[model samples]
Structure formats: structure tokens, C-alpha cells
Target: MKLNSDYWEDRYQNNEIGWNVGKITTPIKNYIDQLKDKTIRILIPGAGNGYEFEYLIHKGFKNVFVVDFASTPLENIKIRIPNLDKNQLILSDFFELEGKYDLIIEQTFFCAIKPNLRENYVHKMNSLLNPKGKLAGLLFQFPLSENGPPFGGSIQEYKKLFEADFKIKYLEIAYNSIKSRKDNELFFIFLLK
Candidate 1:
């Protein structure tokens, strides 16, 4: 239950990653489609199999990077993106990663970590962004409990956790989420405070 590299690597090794939806979810995909700049330095933390990274690169984004503590998914990304730059695939703890990004893509990463680390995740994400940078993507909406890596959260909880540090540009139930996640995901856009 440490949720460390070994924990995650084992999940990948055992094919137990339930968080991966097999493709970029519609909310995120629609967000990416509206992005006008392809040069932005982007980071996707806990990016299992990196469908977002793959989508970005294929769409001509040049500075996309994905970090996961597990080696298996990073290798998976490398194989899928045969021309990928080595520097773009980072295998390290998300909190230990150092970089300034214009945008940070959050997927199931927040839910995977122990809830106690939520504040630390916020701090690290803020530090890793360039001035006025955005932290965007889905957050699960449900009751919180001790039973999961896909931990659930509610809108009130998320606001109390993030509002002091980020401008809540948008926080609402996602209208375009994939069917399985419909009504259970909040699509958000938070800019640095």
C-alpha cells in the first residue's frame, strides 16, 4: 500500500491497471483539439500507456513529456511512439520530477495516490508549471473511501483543496466524458494563482 515505484511497476507487470481507459477520454481529447499552440511544454504525470502523449505527438505537439514511476508504461510509450525522444519519457516519482511546464495533464494520477498526499500533489504541480501555467483534466467524483487507487472525490472537496492556489477557470461535470465515466468525472481548468 506504499504506492511507490515497485507498487506501480508491479501493477503494470501484472496488467492490473484499471485506470487506463485504452484511449484519451473525450473531455481531454476535445480540450486538446482546441489548443492553438503546439510548442507548449506539457507534462502528463502518472501517464499509464500515455494515450494523451501519443495523441499530442501525433497532432504535432513538440514538447510533450510523460512521467510515471513504473518502467513498463514508459517502455510501452516508447514502443508505440517509435520516434519518441528519450527525454520525453520520464521514469521517476512525480514529486521528484523537475521541469517547468505550460500545462500539466492529470488523468487518474490524483486518485491513485494516497489521499494524504493530495496537498503535496498540488504543491508539486504548481511548482512545476511556468508562470500562469495551467493544470487541467479530469478528477473523479464520488464518495471518498480507503478501498482504492481509483479513489473517489467530490466537487466541494476539490474546491476546498485547490481554490486557494488556482483560479477555477472551469470545474463542472464533464459533458463529453467517455460512456463509462459519464457523470462521474469533473473536467477542470485551473490556472496558477
Candidate 2:
């Protein structure tokens, strides 16, 4: 199946986003809470509904940006965070975006793409960050197969994929995952190599 803008947009149009957690997950919130730099340029690609964006803004992180080609989710974020800057709410394909970010967030986005594009995803993420920038967040740890937008992946696969361009700062099962995802997700931090 084509997992393009039309496919993802359709998911939002049909209210079929099971991957959306409705709120920022605990692991990400805890990470953000510990960050001292409020001015860091942060990017959240494929941000469905942007709960993280709202959470970051509420916490006073002023340089947050989110991109998702789906109109429904971007509109939802605008309604939720009424004061969000239009320039930062990017309604475009993640792979086509061009920018340098201090940090990039990964939620369910990586797995949402087709498995063959995993390598390209890594390259795109590497190019999007400035030197020493980081790509951090959660990844599913289940077996991968040909059956989903919520495709599964293992820790080993992720390491092998990202290590070439990023220094693996942390990669392990997340302790604070919401109960629904406990033991099934890995929280990771990959800094530019």
C-alpha cells in the first residue's frame, strides 16, 4: 500500500489514527522537563495532532516546530494551540523538509514509513540536524513484517540503521512508556556523529 500523503491524510480524515496517544507520552515529557534550553530549535516530523508540540509550548519552549502532510492533524494542533506560529506548523512531507534543528523528535513516525525507506529516513534525519544535534524519542520494539503503518522494529535493527550517522547515546526499553506501550517500546537518543 502507498504510505504517502494521501494515505496518511486519509487516516486523519477517517479518524483512524490509533498511533496517536492523545497526549504527550510520559517518557517524552520527562525528557523535555529536564531540558534547560528553552530556545533550542526543535522539530517534530510526522507529528500527528501534535500533543508534544502543545506540551512543549505550554512548558515555554518557544522554538518548537512540527510537520505533517496531513491537514487534519495540523489543523487540530492549530485549534489546540491557538497561538501557534503558522510558519512553524509545516504542512509538508517530512522527507521534503529542509532545515537545521537542535533536536528532532521521533514518535511513531519512523515505523509509519515503509521498511525499505528506513535507510533513507536515517539519512534524511542526519541531514536535517546541525552538528551535534540530536534525534531523540521512542521506537517500537516488536517484530517487523509487511503488515502496517505501525510497523514494528527491534533494538538491533535500529542500532545498525542509525549508528552510521549518529552516536548512539541511549537505546533501551523505556521505563516510563504508557501502560499500553510498556515493554514494547525503546526510548533512544542519537546525536550527530
Candidate 3:
């Protein structure tokens, strides 16, 4: 019931990660493609296997970082991305992490946490970012219900949750989601307010 580090670690250890897309998702890929500054510091929290982290490195973004409390997935990412900077592959709980970044990439992480921590998550995200820094990625688009790690949510709910700390730059149905998530995801870009 509690989606803590142990819960996520077990999912990776047992190979039960349905959310591991194996590669960067389309919406995230597209968003990265348009970024003009390779120097911007980027953080990818709850990054399982970290395809996006590798992609950013390959694209010449030197300050990209990935944080996850689970060792298995972080190890997998290190193995897969052989050239990854040791400092960039952080092994720590997302909420407990420190340092400011220009951007944060969200994927399945938002849904993995218990709903009660939503406000804390938002506050932590705001704290991790530099002034005017952005948070961008996909959010599952559906009704919020009790049953899930991949908990679903509506745009209205997302707006209410993030509006207090971020300027919602873009939040809409992601046109580039992978086939399985086509109509079920929202691509969002929010700047620290």
C-alpha cells in the first residue's frame, strides 16, 4: 500500500516494473530536442534505468543527473550508461535530495508516491529548482482513484496542485505518447513561480 523506496526497490528486483519504458518516452524526447542550452542543470527523479539521462549525456548535456533510492535500477542505469558521471547518478530518496537544477524531468514518479504526499512532492520540486527553472514531462490523464502506483489524475486536479508554486506553461494531452499511453497522458511544462 505504501509506495516507498522499498516498494519501488522490490518492483525493480522482481522485474515488475511495467512503467519502465526501456527508452525515453516521446513527449520527453520532443521536449529535450527543443532545448537550446546544453549547460542547464537537469534532474530526473525516480529515474528507473534512466534512458533520458543517457540521452541527455549523449546529446552533450554535462549537468544532467538522475536520482532514485533503489540501487538496482540506478546500477542498471550505470551499467547501461557506461560513461555516466559518478556524481550524477545519485542514490537517494527524491524528497531528501539537495541542490538546485534548471530543470526536472517527470515520468512515472508522480504516480508512484502516495497521494498524501502530493503537496510535499510539489514543494520539494519547487525547492529543487532554481528561480524560473522548469519541470517538464508526462502525467497520466485520468480520474484520481484509490487503487494505484500509476495513480491517474485529471488536468484540473494537476492545475490546482501545481498552480501555487509553478506557472503552468503547458499542460495538455501529449500528442507524442507511446501507443499504449496515447490518450492517457498529459505533457506538461511548468516554471517555478
Residue-wise C-alpha lDDT for candidate 2, range 1-193, written one tens digit per residue: 8888899889899989888778999999998889999999999998999989899999999999999978889999888878767998998988899999999999889989899999999999999999999999999999999899789999999999998999999999999999999999999999999
TM-scores for every predicted model: 0.98, 0.98, 0.97
Q: In candidate 3, what are the lDDT values of residues 1-193, reduced to their tens digit?
A: 7677788889898999898878988889889999999999999998989988888988989999999978899899878878766899998988899999999999888988878889999999999999989999989998888798788899999999999999999999998889999999999999999
lDDT of each: 0.93, 0.92, 0.91
**Model 3 misplaced stretches (Cα beyond 4 Å):** none
Model 3 has an lDDT value of 0.91
Give me the overall lDDT of model 1: 0.93
Candidate 2 least-lDDT 10 residues = 76-85
Error of 3 at 35 (Å): 0.8
Instruction: Write the number of the candidate with greater lDDT, choosing between 1 and 3.
Output: 1
- lDDT at position 100, candidate 3: 98
